[model samples]
Target chain A: MTGRTRRPPTGAAVLQPHITSAITEAVLDELAERGYGRLSMEGVARRAGVGKSALYRRWPCKQDMVLAVLSQMSVPLAEFPDTGSLRGDLIAGLGAVHDWLTHPRFVLILPDLTAEAARNPALAEAIQATIGTPRRQLASAALHRAVERGELPAGLNLELALDLIAAPIHWRLNVRRAPIEPGYLEALADHLMRALGATERH
Target chain B: MTGRTRRPPTGAAVLQPHITSAITEAVLDELAERGYGRLSMEGVARRAGVGKSALYRRWPCKQDMVLAVLSQMSVPLAEFPDTGSLRGDLIAGLGAVHDWLTHPRFVLILPDLTAEAARNPALAEAIQATIGTPRRQLASAALHRAVERGELPAGLNLELALDLIAAPIHWRLNVRRAPIEPGYLEALADHLMRALGATERH
Candidate 1:
């Protein structure tokens, strides 16, 4: 047992880059087809055209492999443009999120993470760290820009501002189980900008 | 061809009432015990101490059984009170919903329902008809009462008002994977009421 104990990351630790990337792709595809509950290491190995022993040589279990796959999905901040307007920035960010939400792999992955989270509260933090924090920060930055430009209220709250822009798309996908049509997106962006727009005579 | 085409509302249909209650209890316990998919129809039947045939007789499948359980969770509305003020009425009504959202079942059920909704859009409608419509109407009536009392603008957009309140709960439960904590709910209700609140300035 002592032989396999872990230590803090060292400057010279060897990483198995090829196997991990190949396995990650295979696992994602398997999740899209079979969903989380039915996914097995054997299935992933078979699909990746590798032996079971080869997979076990890398990750100890399904959760570890899954985390490796999910961690690869870095939120690309480059896509979030600074269009010199808060609403424009928000619209771009929200629109990019639309693709991720509707991906077949996501539909399968999210439920399992949350279902596992009920028992392991720590996993909730993991999910937030991986996906939620970056998302809110991106929106918050755009809102801050708006506040600085005097486009919003004097006492406008940042967290609440993020929530305001974020909640609608979240609702559209999660609850409605429908796409936010372009028409609705236009309406939502227009309405939210107007709502947050300050009174002219104030 | 018509020999056994019809359901007795008895074989599976007749036994539905008994198993419906049993399944509801089973799901709650199983969510605690086994998470979701580890929950098998055979398992619920075995635990309920009934034959698998009996469960099959009542529910065509697991989805059907879950749908019945969800319909029963009326979750005690906070009695959208007549506080005689727009802010008061909106806050109280939203506050009540916020409390109901704290239940663990909402987290488990909402994602399950949403996943199923992706497969069966008709089930989505059934869920809405059984649950969502009434929930919306309940909040809408409270807001409508505010309009009637001359406390809010008479033309306050009802659908938008419902979205303002309802969307946040779904957002927190589904995306944030965070509990709809009271402070967040209060803040949401306060800020939303201000944003969507009917104008009184003449």
Candidate 2:
């Protein structure tokens, strides 16, 4: 279906928002079909009904396109509402992670991209710069808030704590492909609070 | 280096152990070079200096060959000596996981194989059946020993506990590409015991 011929976008359709969204969607479709190892700008352009120049103007390389699309998709999803308690915030935050990992497009895209990143150092750097660092910062904001509110130890290892919050869910949903039973997030939050030495407000 | 032509093995070198080890090593080399997506039986045969029949005799397809090689490499590495206490056993077990993820061959092989497994259901099943199940069983045996020693609650959720042990290290070392500082494992073991509600033995 992605290989079907289509008329190129008109001059007016070359607007940044229009063409950028089309290209991003096309990249996701291509990744789902071809996986990241085989994804090409040519393929995305064809799939988006745009010319190669349109893609090249936007992102000079596949890594750029992939990272741009991924960051756009994931960064906003990383934000967790201030739920007033570390327990509440963690449960809310991990629930968002649960939804994202179980989402159909992400389920297909992440493993392939992660695999490609392992082999390509430039892409790895791009991913960390664009996706990994920003997302972790957003997640860490919650812990910073918790520390300010006297809910956690000031000396908490924020880096390790962030990994603790996200990794088990990822390992279960992505690696083990297991179901997250109802109330799992609450239990996980409790375990995490204990692991990080969080104290509840009186 | 893997692309260099080699003289075919002599009739004497076709002995089972010799040919099997050569093919298995070639699979790791090919996986590290070409990754699982592009690896092929022909490449393995060429890399191993064996006839294609030598490969077909062992595996019906590329996935089979890959899973076979990975199983051989990982299952033995999964063995962790029982260190008597749950804390000691966990530290020892997670250390093995840390080592395997950092090992050069596995560092290259794991992500590619994981990505391939995400796309191919049969390969996923083969991986889970061969590598995942056996490795988890070995890890679980340590927990079973701990439970017998009365070091953990009888109601411990073995699956979640296992995920807790492995996920942070994987996320840190593989996903985030961060360094595991010295003494980190000991601290991680301490945190894990608390997270799992272990009753420490004085």
Candidate 3:
């Protein structure tokens, strides 16, 4: 694999705010190894080889730190594989969701982010910037495709259909706490298609 | 509204395990008041009006102490509503979910609990016990009811069906990190009924 080479060094490293990205990756590894509750600023600082003061200067605390970790883990909705059909687009979109959220690191990190968001609006904004944008975009895309194809009737409340497809999958992982599997994707797709007035012939 | 009346205490004031329960409740309240990142055991003990020694005698560290706080908030699955008919019953089950999980205290508390659980098995187990049991009971009840009602195809995979209804919902709150609204409940109930090869017609 080719790696990007940087230009010759300038006066001082700008720190580009990307140092947190690398440090956060190390923190995620530390989390997988040590677990979220057990993770510490001292431990992450040591593991990332950055001074704890540098870490705190940016994060202020672990909640902000953890949200940064989660921000990177979210997949963008625009990344959906497009092949020109609503059925094709949806299966790919839901399938991507299946792959992204079910990972162990995500499951662990997200709850902390949500908890932090409940108290800290700044951290919540970061979370929204990274994760929520993608989630909403995907839903909007699917609904737009349906309307364009005349599959969904005019004035058919697209947001509600979006909720139908996504909300069930989310409910399972968060409240019901069940395993994500292939059958679930199929079921959700099947139900959502019918609700959107799309036929299963695809 | 009737209130629970407390009986007069017996003469001797001996230490008991209930103090652990009381302390855990206090910590949970503090967690809601102040975000988990700001949570400190000394603060907890101060709020609990207990000596630090008393708190330390129980859990070895902050992780274990928070784990105790989470463990108490869990509700038993035995309360899964048994109202007749799959749609009615599932809605009731969902309502039970809303009552415990979406309740003001729990909505904030759960994200922290889940974050803690994702990295810790014992904590995951404790969280899952509160989460999984109810879904299992609801799914099992629905499957059995369907079979008895001749609504489901014979020899259907009840477990997969359960996961279908379940996993999506789980991610909605924890991953998408949104609240479950009334319309969400209705769509889920309607979709689950039809997907399992039953009638959505009331």
- Cα interface RMSD of each candidate: 3.0, 1.1, 3.8
lDDT of 1 by residue, A55-153 (tens): 887778887677657755635531467887766766776676665566667765665555555446666677677667876776667777777877777
Can you tell me the DockQ of model 1? 0.28
Q: Which CAPRI category fits model 1?
A: acceptable
In order, what lDDT does every prediction score? 0.66, 0.84, 0.64
Query: By DockQ, who's the top model here?
Result: 2
Q: Estimate each model's TM-score.
A: 0.75, 0.89, 0.67
Q: What is the per-residue lDDT of model 2 for residues B68-109, given as tens digits with 9 covering 90 to 100?
A: 888888888778788888988888898998987887788878
In the predicted model 2, the residue pairs found to clash are none
The list of candidate 2 runs beyond 4 A from truth reads A1-14, A200-202, B1-15
When summed lDDT is taken over every stretch of 10 residues in candidate 2 chain A, the lowest stretch is A7-16
List residue ranges in candidate 1 displaced over 4 A.
A1-21, A50-64, A77-79, A194-202, B1-24, B31-64, B75-79, B119-122, B149-160, B179-182, B200-202
For model 2, how does the per-residue alpha-carbon lDDT over A1-202 read when each residue is reduced to its tens digit?
A: 2567567677644446778888989998888888887788889999999999998887778888888898998888889789898888898999988887776788888877777778777887888899889989999999999999999999988877888888999887766666788877888887788788888555
Please give the fraction of native interface contacts (Cα pairs under 8 Å between A and B) kept by each candidate.
Answer: 0.26, 0.52, 0.36
